[model samples]
Target: MSYVGRFAPSPSGPLHFGSLVAALGSYFQAKSQHGKWLVRMEDLDPPREMPGASDLILATLEAYHLHWDDEVIYQSQRHHYYQDQIEQWIASKEAYYCQCTRRQIKQSGGFYLGTCRDAALTPEQPCSVRFKVPTAIDHFIDQKHGRIAIPKALADEDFIIKRRDGLYAYNLAVVLDDIEQGVTEVVRGADLIEPTGRQINLYHAMKQPEVSYLHLPLALDEHGNKLSKQNHAPALNNEEPIETLLSAMTFLGFDIDAHITSANLDEIIAWGCQNWSLQQLPNSLASTARF
Candidate 1:
């Protein structure tokens, strides 16, 4: 398959430094290989989404010179797509209804213990649908982090596909859209490494081709906390686009020489496409103290 990648961001807030780092990492990886880079707005949860956040995200990407190949995808508009696949899974017994809450799962040793697996209960208004994780995926190959082992016991637990509020779950939505977009690789932050296994199982259960993974270092604040919207990460200031882009490039372990660093936006990005290497960076997560 021809190389293809994406930078899907939730429209919960404006783009931040961490989001920029992830976007640059994915963009560089795809462009370096002459692949198509797409953008998607994961805006399913209306309660968490901010008004005008999606447009802001697109505008921010444009301002940063991270151009995408095709029209942007919004998750809210694809509810039918997610719902159709979920219904098919339920009919085929690949997934089932789940009524367990977070507190109940936490009481059951952190990970879900499949309490409602055999309930055969009718789907309710406030219930979630859990995917029946097949035992097919034992491990996933991360391009930068190497092989990540998954225990068979963990796969036996049912993971949610739709939430109690009727919103689609990230794992399910992501895998389906990735398949739909033909995403060949997923270059993201190390914070999402833990969900890779479950998503791998989604690929197998959904019978979609698995995409390659390349998790970049998590961008951290001075306090060592991962910078994120929920963590109150400040939005990226488009006023200093060049400085922000250069800093993000350097954070990704690129050797931005003085020539490239001082070049115009388009030139600097062109240089990045020619020289970016996902394999060159250390696999471990690092902090961006200056952020």
Candidate 2:
């Protein structure tokens, strides 16, 4: 089968240094393999989404020469698809509505203890649908981190699939979108490593094919926290696209000489795709580029 990769960025805010690293890493990986690369806007959570953030993100990607194939997909337009999958899961008895509050779970070791797994409650009382997690999940391999096993203590939590407000949860939306889009590989930051296992389990429950996962190291601020919209990280400057791309490439373990700084975006991308290697990436979480 032909390889298909994607960079699905949430439109909560503009692309920051961390988002740039993820985009460039996935872009080069696909380009190097001569595979198709696509982009998707994960704008499902309206409350967290910033106005015009999606358009600004696309413009930034274009400015950095990270063009995608086919029409970009928006999650907001695909609500029906997620609903269909949820209905199927419900029919199969693989999911159940839970009325457990945050305080209840917090008092029970921070993981949902299946408090409402068998509760016969109507949807009128504002309940979230949760997946019935299995007792044990087998180990799955990470391209960068190697074979990894998620302990039952962490994997046994009954996780939510649909929020109380009826919005599709991230795990459900992402898994369904990947299956629909034919994504063969997922490349993103290490912050999502644990979620990958959960998604893998969901894929198995849904009888969908498993996709390879590669989680790149996260970019951290001076305070040692990951750069993210929640942390108030500054957005990328569209005026200096090349500078941002080059900085991102360097963060991904690419060795670009000072002379290469004069190269255009296309030329830099060409070199990057040709020279991209997973082994060059640092395993340490502290790996970052100096701004």
Candidate 3:
């Protein structure tokens, strides 16, 4: 299959420097391999979404000259598809409804203790649906991090797929979307490393084709906190696309010494793609000024 990669960003806030790093990394990786790069709007969580954040993100990408192949996909428009997958899992007994409240789980530590696995409740009880995690260790080799073994404790934790409030969980939606979009490889931040195991289990349960994963180092703030909307990270400067793009290139481990004088975003990205190398990425996350 032709290499397919994506940059799926939530529209909860504007695109920050951290978000740009991820987008640029994935974009160059795909372009360098002569593959297709697509963008997907992960707007499933309505409660956290900003009013016009989706449009703003698209505008920001355009301003940066990071164009995507084909039309962008919005997750909110695929609710029925996710619901159908959930129903199939239920019919196959691979998923169960849980009536356990947040207080119960909090009291017993963070992981859900499978209290509702054998509960005598109907689907109409307003219960959240959870995937019955498998016992065997799910292992996958990270393109950058080498072989990874997910702990049994985490692997066995019965995680949620559909929330009690009727929102589709991120893990479920992401897995389904990747399979549907035929994503052969995933390029994302290391913050999502833990969730990769759960998603891999889901892929196995569904018997779907496995996709390779590369978790890039996260950009941090001077205080050591991950730069994010919650941390008040400033949005990308759409007006100064070259400066922002060059900064993102450096974050991805590119040497832009000669091309630092590049006049435009296109020239920078073109040169960056021509010289993109996964081996050049730093193994550890680093802090940068909050621009």
TM-score for each predicted model, relative to the true structure: 0.95, 0.96, 0.96
**What lDDT tens digits, residue by residue, belong to model 2 across residues 183-214?**
99999888887777788888888788889988
- List clashing residue pairs in candidate 1: none
Q: Which ten residues in a row have the lowest lDDT in candidate 2?
A: 282-291
Lowest-sum lDDT 10-residue window in model 1? 282-291
Error of 2 at 98 (Å): 0.5
Clashes of each: 0, 0, 0
Native-vs-model 2 lDDT?
0.86
Deviation in Å, model 1, residue 83 alpha carbon:
0.9
